[model samples]
Target: MRLSRSFLPTLKENPAEAQITSHRLMLRAGLIRQTSAGIYAWLPAGLKVLRNIANIVRAEQDAIGAQEMLMPTLQSSELWKRSGRYDAYGPEMLRIRDRHERDLLYGPTNEEMVTDLFGQVVKSYRELPQVLYHVQWKFRDEVRPRFGVMRGREFYMKDAYSFDVDYDAAVDSYRRMMLAYLRTFQRLGVKAIPMVADTGPIGGELSHEFLVLAPTGESGVFFDGAFEEQDWLSEAVDISDRESLAKFFARMTSFYAATDEKHDEAQWAKVPPERRREGRGIEVGHIFHFGRKYTESMDISVSGPDGAPLYPEMGSYGIGVSRLVAAIIEASHDEQGIIWPQSVAPFAAVIINLKNGDAQCDEICERLYAAAPEHLLYDDRGERAGVKFADADLMGHPWQVIVGPRGAKAGIVEVKNRASGERSEMPVDAVLAHIGVGA
Candidate 1:
């Protein structure tokens, strides 16, 4: 992870095609590169961030008892046809034909495929409640894919499917996902408000879109200001207790929040003017309670207690795993560059050898690098101190430990907080302690 040997291709000037802060910073910071209109190749630094985000999503999903299992990027078009969506999905679906002329597609979503799988194996109500998720690449042919990964045609997503025997059970599954999404965003250092949203092609009457407030966000959202103050993490989550889950559900639904598609002027006007907040927001996650939509269409049925054949109620939850990289930048960057949250930061800290070839600086940086975690990126490049500092800021590591000639000679180093712009000169051992690395 030495910067001198790393593949970070930071740019000095903003790329002209980047219309948003996240897009510009992503390019300038060398996190990603556009391979096509909306497809990107994640470089080393970008891939680290992507993995970090995926890990967070995985942890939160696991907390709610959702099992992780990857689905394929390419799916047979027959699956979509079985669900009656092959024709309905239209242009966004990347339709293709194999050499033998069999229809195929890069799956935009996995509802139909998951349903088909569920129907084959899960027949009894004993397996009534199940949540399976995957972090995988998805393709959607956006007519105008712009804003970097924020609206990319090819992107990574964490999509989960929940199957339950009936509507009531499905609602519970939706609540679990809602809580998991809140916890996921909270751990990522972002406040995402759950707003009622249109189900769109997913075709669900009950749906919630988790939106993170950002000036450059595409969706206009309105909500009660109280949502900003609510701490979803502090509330106890008892998924096994139905009453407790219902209580949590009640608390979340009490808030008045809606995206443009679900906005009601009369309901919004009812809020006191001071409590009303209208702002642009990025949709980071969505959950749907689509009772029997995919299951019935795809013949996914389970045996009821009364021995009747019944289609399982279903829900799908999605998090924009790749888009979150851009969303985080949009919500947290300053003029210098991205200020990554520690949880999702590619590197917790960057060690900058301000005087690269200087013996003392090199010694100090090398020592710190040896002790730091594998994720730490040591900037051992022979670049100017200013350039190194600027690049460190642009790359958005949560902290920067500068081993300058002066500090190195003094047996000290300067630890700079990327977000606060605060620098503290301390003994090398203290620097190690500050960064949670043993000397």
Candidate 2:
């Protein structure tokens, strides 16, 4: 993508409406624009990051046996009514009436709808276990929507529902989903620890929220630093083996992690004082083992082996797909701008043409750009070297390939790691190798 031709509308100053670091940086970096109160239109760069996050969430979900499907943003109010929550959901739900005066709503969550759909199709214990998920836009009428996409009124989300034969089976599903969330966040290049959380409107007795630690986070947290030492992605766990799942669950819970709301001094003291870490955290994902809350409320049931009707034990897992963009920025940005994780960066690297009009500089940049045209952003704009450098840093690509006339002429370019601020002079031929791209 050529900067001169791209629709990136970066700003020199932050927008007045943006209060949080992520919101302010997102506006100035041209990643998103506010279209309405608490709503945004994701620009090219922002949408790329959004899709990358969603794809990782999808892949992790699929790996855990969850099947993906699309669900409507608008749902019939009848589903909520049958579950006895239509009136109780409050102002956050955007209730509407169609031409026939039939009631409808923009779904804030899909527990009731999913329960009804599952009951309509599955009738017996044979198909007792299933995990279904969808990545879609959701609307919630926040009285005061703030913090950019972090607390947006309309945002993208990935919600999955699991149905099982009984409480024990449902618990297994919850553990598997937790493992998936850990793997998902690890791959996305963020440290999100699971903490005990209230179910709230989701109405579950067992719940956990994944919080990404950040200095500017909303919730104060106390945790054991051991969480940083464990690599979830490389940990081997057999999803089908209940004993393995239980051991994994036990190990995760063994860590002392909690938000201020649920903090326990007794538990905190149990950790080695030196290994204890206190910080602020932003909630990015949540999982709940609600058992028969929805199934019983909606009267959804399956026939047991004994021919008796049994309400399926269930669980709900959610990841704020769009909010993660802001969360990642909140956790990773520095004074210059966002230092994007390679997995979710809009571009793998930006090729900054320090002398855009110079033939030798253009030749070197074009060569690097062509090596992976789709993954590279070529700054071919006729802007000053300062503007190009600032924009490259602001956009926060993992790497910046500098092509100045002097270096270009020598067939050597300077490569800088965005996160480390480390620069290396490399042969033009070695640029792709340094950035982990195939020649």
Backbone clashes under 3 angstroms, per model: 0, 0
Q: In candidate 1, what residue range of length 10 has the lowest lDDT sum?
A: 430-439
lDDT digits (tens) for residues 1-439 of candidate 1:
9887889999999999999999999999999999999999999889999999999999999998999988899999889888899999989999989999999999999998888877888889987798999999999999999999999999999999999877888888998889889889988988889999999998989999999899989999999998788877687879888788889999988879999999999999888999999999999999999899888888778898988988888999999999999999989998889999988898989998877678998888888888875858998877787898889889999999888887788898889899888889999877767866554
User: How many clashes (backbone atoms < 3 Å, residues ≥3 apart in a chain or on different chains) does model 1 have?
Assistant: 0
State, as a TM-score between 0 and 1, how close model 1 is to the true structure: 0.98
| CA lDDT of each prediction against the hidden true structure | 0.90, 0.92
Model 2: which ten-residue window has the lowest total lDDT?
227-236
lDDT of 2 by residue, 1-439 (tens): 9999999999888788888999999999889999999999999999999999999999999999999988899999999998889999899999999999999999999998888889889999899799999999999999999999999899999999999999999999999999999889989999899998878898889999999988878889888998778765566899999999999999889888888888899989999999999988899999999999889889999999999999999999999999999999999998889999999999999999988778999888888888898789999999898999999999899999999998888899999999999999999998898898765
Tell me the deviation in Å of residue 68 in model 2.
0.2
**Model 2 — TM-score against the truth?**
0.97
